[model samples]
Target: MKIDDWLLEILACPACKSPLRAESEELACTSCGLIYPVRDDIPVLLVDEARKPS
Candidate 1:
């Protein structure tokens, strides 16, 4: 199952305490420009997997 809105409520960026938006197959933190990938509908909120800002 995918990470629901309830789960998102408690999810914060590891680098910065910012809200995230659902991107294509990932959750992106707008403030820090971190992209948290989602695998099998599960959000991988890891700093290593996060994409750096362009």
Candidate 2:
């Protein structure tokens, strides 16, 4: 699912508090490289739920 531009603009990484960029079906942290999943169009910002950058 695609996240809205406005929401993507405000969404931050729960771990590093850095800005996130929409990537396909996930929101990836620009700073810390944590990949947050977008489930049902809702961003799962939990640090435990995030995937480490590969």
Per-candidate TM-score against the hidden true structure: 0.80, 0.92
Highest TM-score among the candidates is held by which one?
2
Q: Model 1 — which ten-residue stretch has the worst lDDT?
A: 1-10
lDDT of 2 by residue, 2-50 (tens): 6778888888888888899988999899999999888898999998998
Model 1 alpha-carbon miss at residue 24, Å: 2.2
Whole-model lDDT, model 1? 0.84
User: Local distance difference test, per candidate?
Assistant: 0.84, 0.89
lDDT of 2 at 24: 90
What is every candidate's alpha-carbon RMSD to the true fold? 1.7, 0.8
Off by over 4 Å in 1: none
